[model samples]
Target: MPLPLPPLFAAWRQSLRAGYAWKSLRGDLSAGLTVGIIAIPLAMALAIAVGVAPQHGLYTVLVAAPLIALCGGSRFNVSGPTAAFVVILLPITQQFGLGGLLLCTLMAGLILIALGLLRAGRLIEFIPYPVTLGFTAGIGIVIATLQLKDLFGLSLAAQPHNYVEQLSLLLHSLPSLQVGDSLVAVVCLAVLVLWPRWVPRVPGHLAALAVGAGLALLLERAGLPVATLGERFSYHLDGIEYPGIPPFLPSLAWPWQLSGADGQPLQLSFELIRQLLAPAFAIAMLGAIESLLCAVVADGMTGSKHDPNGELIGQGIGNLVAPFFGGITATAAIARSAANVRAGACSPLAAIIHAGVVLIAILYLAPLFSYLPMAALAALLLIVAWNMSEARHVQHTLRIAPRSDVLVLLTCLILTVLFDMVLAVGVGLLLAAGLFIKRMSDLTDTAALPKHFHHALSDLPEHVLVYAIRGPLFFGAAEKALSVLRRLSPGVQVVIVDISAVPLLDMTALAALANVLRDYRAQGVGLVLSGPTAQVRLQLRRAGIQRVDGQLAYVRDLPQARVKALRWAGGSKT
Candidate 1:
């Protein structure tokens, strides 16, 4: 049902052609280590933001990063869990739990794989830039709002589904804030913000995470009020009280074993799987956009070209496999990719090594992760949301873009925040397509020939009239163009349509032309066509429309149409 992978795997192809040297290998190693450290906290943070265990994020990185590097076309793209998936994944988890997420991811992976095999990577650009901007801004706002409870260490008894309700709940619970938790969250937030600027060589999130974990331990030991991951999830390993995270390797997990929040067992029914299709499609679309955009940014930064279709296939394989290994959705993370490029990464080896390095950290450091404050993770998410909002881009678009485009942007933003990504994108695309059609229609025009052009004809005959059509004679503009025929002079005997400027025509345009021709035939006027381009010529001939008053004649140029019209008008005898 699907095509095979390209002739050669992208990473191997690059290695063969680019001459992977020891010098490049050295650069790849350095960049890989830097990005690996940088990627660690982000992976954990993104998973938590989506209401999953921190380890799920790490699982995604361990599984997806290396696979994408091996199969993907972009040498520098860093694939893993990202903030962009949070909005889409949150509702799915809340509704259907982890099982639904796994199944949805699997379905999305299949779709992406098909897209790549079909070489449809270039179709991703069809989404309007304004629509993406609007929805991304909306997701950012939603993410920030969702984190408010953790940001303030408020004891919200239950999380609300909608943004406004979540904010209301946060405000209501603010008085119940834990002082130590609040303080630790603020300190971690500050470190995450300033650490990169202060220590340029080290990854800031890891530093902030350490700061939060240390403060959390201090508060817990001192018997102050704080909520560590240990307090929420208790576990035992080797007769020790492991705080939160489970020590793990890449191991297969069954998707059907998922349970609901109320601890109800999962059922693999047809209706349930059918309901997930929309969300799965949304995930696929978001993944494609995020990954391709990351690759584009990588290309620009490194002055390297990436095969988008190959990259999509690679991402498909990563997502398709990760869910079985206790992981969630993933894509090419833009920040890490940019970091890899800046750190002198020469190939996908950097990304592969990054995955390996994170795996090593998982073996050694994951045990201590349970002592980290949940509020600290929430703080990291706040910074991520801030970056994703792109407030500067929104402000600039509003100031400079056309009013119609602004409307699309605002509509998409509102819909996304109030509804979901799928609905927002659907409505936004509809608006864009409608606007495009209207603009095209506006460009097409029809006009009767002015008096000065009569001399170019074989002989000036009063009953032979000419009309010129300009711009694309497609469905959108066809009706308007044909309406000009209604203004034909009463004594006109032959109608000559000069289609020299018409680039192409569709079925709707042909139907409209047929209607106009029938109306002219009712008035005893014959029609002569002129100067159809090769494609349009085929379409007109296939239409097989015959003139009722006289035989329909197709001409090579305007003068030939003039001669045909003269014959129809009895001009040779004159």
Candidate 2:
């Protein structure tokens, strides 16, 4: 057999076929510049949130954005290091360092590629809404909480891994809050909240960060030092050191060659790969969900369709290539993608140009970025967390949603906050699946058919009983729906079961039916299966439930079944 064609660059090809005009290119340029300005502060802040140098985040956008745009299935999706990754990436960085984190990203990229090749992108839709909401809310809470140290300028001896412990540490260190940092954070936050209303044309984040950086510089001159990016982070080149981010393009290098948790080279081994497998899978799953959801949102905004599998492959390629360029796990940022659409993005060229904007910032504006206050970045992330949590939506859902859905939501939320996303998602899916099965089973029912419903059934022999089975006969519902057959009275000479309404019959249902047949044979009663749909009939015969002398019989409809039952009753030994 010939191999199937790969779903590569599907969106790019589609947009090309649609014909790009100069007008479209102009729109793309405008959108790219707009979103690029928005992404700069966000990327740095997310990298800081993940316990890495801010440059790595910029590197992610520099590499991943253009690659995803060139190869992905969504024309307007802007891929980058997003706030959603902080909860997962922070722990990895703490435990494994940059090298381990990058290696994990590489593994996740491969997994995503495999998922795309298997055509599993559409499966993301099966995840229940409550599950997504709960985990996101939990993640938002975690991200917001982690930013508190910087937001308050609290000095910590060490950061703990557990959420409760982290909270305790933050509370204990609250007395050490630097007034200068608090002032910077408050001013930056005010600007972020109000700038959009004051100047609707300009992005709030850029203005807020600019104001915060200026405030931090003034505070330092006033003998009240608030920590800035240049003060907290530095990089070495040749022999001299550069403050904040490095002003250069990302160079190629192996992920495993970077520093580990102990500030030494990470040892790449089978055991290490095994250890990272679970986290890698988690990254891949989350990336797939985030990217596909973003693509769907873009589709709704632009009235355009997306090729989901092609998008997955493109994301996989971006992630796979990014680690070598000092990038971390990246996905389509929803807010950025929304901003792209609102800024008049017309094609993948906009995303490609967004990458160009980031590249320009790295080369020209890198030194100035060092002046951005940590508190300002923290303040920015606080807003991100607020938007991400969707607290109002969660409240509405709790009020109006079914109790089972509420339970799933709360369970996922609590688990995610306390433990991790992997456990939360796994348990939530299993719980949802079990609840769904119970609900489906409740809908399947078997009951005696009333003779008055059909004129031909009205004169049926008193010794013959006809029952109708409805709904799919899957495992959960099979035994309960078919158990009625075992309760037939001893005086009953023949039982006609009408199953035309049944839409499916699984192995469990077949087994349940076989048990029913055996019980009827033992009771010396004839069984007539009537009105079975073609599928049900095939299942019945395949399970060896064929016509037997005076034991079992099959008929096409209720009328034929009535005749069969009457004839059986007449000749029955009972």
Candidate 3:
């Protein structure tokens, strides 16, 4: 039977049992705390980047991290808001508002759970590498562009719905950029970029936040026109509030309320849900890709395996539950997982603890976040966008990949930027598959050759012939093999087929060979196959071709095959 759990999970279990050392517990605890510290600032930044209040991002980490750790199969896998989802979710939030976005996330979670239970996790590995690279590069570009507003503090009449229009608006607003925001962003970017080199071990993002917030406070006291988090956002109890869950979960209808422009209940439509389907699919695809990629990376660092399906199920459940509490889409975070592993995380417990830390921050420290400068968050994400781009990999793919593969990479990249991720991946995969089939077909060849006995001019020879077969006979080569045999010289007596060179034959090839043999027999040519490989012999035998006497032969070598062909040719004359 196939392995019960996914390979990643199986590996994880093996690692846990094999490498369980007491010394590692302290390291795990230390690492978990370190990762939690780094995640706090990032979680807030990511939530804002997605156009939601910073608290929602914290909520995602708080809700998702524990759920995934408890139910997931990876020991060090950390689940929370990620940069990749920002591009996919932002548009959904813009179009559908928080409710529709939450509903989409909920649907995506259910889809993931279904996929996990169906054992479809391994299928994620089959996603083309070029597709991943392309979409990721595109997402990085989108994220960087999205941060421009805060990065420069541009004042615009409205945010553009599309990337191009956004850029156009940003360029037009360059003169109106807030000097205070610009200075804060520049300083924050500098700190994030340089602090790691100096501090070496301290959480760089935390340092950037401290420095940026301090600078903003000092600037405001100095009478500078800086925009604080408080200036940008206000916690209006009436704006967007988390709904209270009853003691028992209420029915969908009881809780299904859509907000109107005037704060009254508005009628909901099925069309709104239908429009969200594409974006939801995009979220699910990206979540699956990023989470699995993070798991694979963690496996490499920890020398442990993760359960991809279980992880998917966990992610789905987390995402499904998170939006109800004002959370956006969430996934495995590569940076946080690396930090957790590097800090010596011992088990999934560390991730659970990390979630607890985030919860504590949310419950107590949320008000202090109002002092955070928007530019600092933008600077943080700018660094994130740069790291996420994987420019080195993109350059490498372009330089080293084959022309066809490069074409696929470029196609996906352009489509992801010009249209959306769904179109890019769908088209890129189809094109790549088509190109792969064409390449395979080009490598296959088939031809017909005369039997060895037919070369001899004999007195008793009236009609005699032999044919040779070679090469891998698979689906790509089957048609050529059969077509060549059909055009063989007519008026032949005995036909011996040389199969000494055939290394493999699939069912399609076998069927093609059988059909050609049947056609040859109809023309009165006695058919025989000689020198079949051990595998080929077994296949022919199992296919009942061995039972067809005088129609097939499995010889030990070419000499025996030649002798049999001579006797058959002589018999035809007699």
Candidate 4:
């Protein structure tokens, strides 16, 4: 089918046409403000975690939230840079620089848009459940590892891209930890952990960040070592200085205009495009999977069915356009989406209002937010990573799951932490698929020929034999079915294969069947195939397997097959 534009968002349209009352408007406004407040610190934290400026995170939120609200399928879903992308985005950023990262994001956006339009959005479900859990948990561990340096103020000579190497570097720099910075982190982490229990009025994360910032400022005034965003960002990112905020609104800019950390100009060429293709594809798949998963969670909470394809288009467009303003890959954040629902959001209007809140903060409160300590942000991300890891779930899975499933889950986890996410996901999916195939083939069974159904061949000698094939005749099960036929008795004169229970036959299975027929013909035994389905019969006919040399014939049923086999044995069908 040809690709089509995603259908209009009827949910949003309906809300406008219906009598949306002020009661609902108040709920949406309150929800929007609540989501926006929590999002401010998270957006900053996630951006830093991804090794980018805090503004980039806010920029993504500011642009993507509104775009998604206007075009998204889910009313409550909040889309932006999420914790899940931190590991995946880092490698691309290091290899390609900011320009290449943005370009890669744009390409990913285009790919996602194409997938949504093609209605291939449903393919995300095919990713095995274990694979999703493994990689997600693996990512959580990686996120926690990445934050340790900031959490303890352990500045390494360079941050290694590989997890093992990074861990080693972190270990070596352990002696370099500053107590002042550690205390700041402790304050923030404690606030985040205890605030919910003690004081539920203000968002715990925000309160934690504020306390951490105050302590850092006091440490700075007392001449103690404490790193702040102001100290860190003023000299970061290929000479683009930042102390507070850019103070400039987002505007159109070519991604290739930026340079690498080493000052190498990023040239947009076929070679660069080729280099980023794999990363771009990773971004697209991850974004689509995350967004849809968030939408599903929102649906469960709100009893609303979101248009998956429409939401995909909204996500795609957001990622595609946000890059032009120096934003990274954007997608629906599950935690934030869930929060939007819990905050009493009634419609997409809440998301739009949330975006407006972020825009206002960026314009007015950027300087104040810049006072937030990196240590606090690190603590916040550590908490997020802990939640995302789902360690309890993973532990439970490792215990109760089948050995093969455990193997797959562990393989994906090990690969993600020990290597690149691209390799991890690719190998995880392949391993899961192989395991599925093995299980399918195991279910395929063959049984002895039934005598009651062989009454039509009563006149035949007792040496005549029958065999029944069960389950799908796809590649996975074909060899098992053929193995059974190989064990036939030596005195067999006619072989009747009952395929009445078989529903499918691919080329490989057809070839296997042809091989069985050839072996039987060589041994001077007649072969009869019973009950080829319409689709299977079409394939067999196309393969020229119809009655040939009085040995092979496609019969309607077991009785017909018996009669055909007897006739073939008498050399009548020839």
- The numbered model that scores best in TM-score is 2
In model 4, which regions exceed 4 Å deviation? 1-4, 8-11, 14-19, 221-223, 235-242, 450-460, 570-574
Local accuracy of candidate 2 as per-residue lDDT tens digits, 241-332: 87888898988999999999899999999999999999999999999999999999999999999999989998999999999999988999
Writing each residue's lDDT as its tens digit, candidate 4 over 1-574 gives: 9655565574486456545789889978988898899888888888888777778888888887788778877788888889999888887777777777788889999998888788876888899888989999999999999999999999798869788899899999999998889999998988989998997756898889888988998998888788888777753336766686665577788878877555687877899899889889999999998999998999899888888788888888888888888787889988888888888888888888888888889878877876778889899999999999999999999999999889989999999899967888999999999999999888788887556665664555566677778888888889887878877777778877778788888888989888888887788877778887888888889998986675565767766776666665664442
Candidate that beats the other on lDDT, 2 or 4, i.e. the better one = 2
Per-residue C-alpha lDDT of model 3 across residues 405-463, encoded as one tens digit per residue: 89998898888777777888899899888888678666666545533334432333435
Which ranking of candidates, highest lDDT first? Answer: 2, 1, 4, 3
Taken over the whole model, the C-alpha lDDT of each candidate is 0.84, 0.91, 0.76, 0.83
Worst 10 residues of 2 by lDDT: 565-574
TM of each candidate vs. truth: 0.94, 0.98, 0.84, 0.93
Over the stretch 1-574, how does candidate 1's per-residue lDDT look in tens digits?
Answer: 8756562267557655888889899989999999999888788878878877778888888998888888877888999998888989999999888788887888888888878888888999898999999999988888888877776678888878987787788888989988888888899889988888899888888888888888887887788767766666655668987677776685687765766544676787899889888898899899999999999998899777888898888889899999988789989988899999889899998998999888988889876777778788888888888889899999999999998899999999999888887888899999989999998889889888765866765355778777889999888899889888767887888878888899989888899888887777677787888888888888887888634534665677877677667767777742
The weakest ten consecutive residues by lDDT in model 1 span 545-554
Q: Worst lDDT window (10 residues) for model 4?
A: 565-574
Q: Where does candidate 3 have its weakest 10-residue lDDT segment?
A: 242-251
Report model 3's TM-score to 2 decimal places.
Answer: 0.84
Q: Cα deviation of 132 in candidate 1 (Å)?
A: 1.5
RMSD of each: 2.4, 1.7, 4.9, 2.9
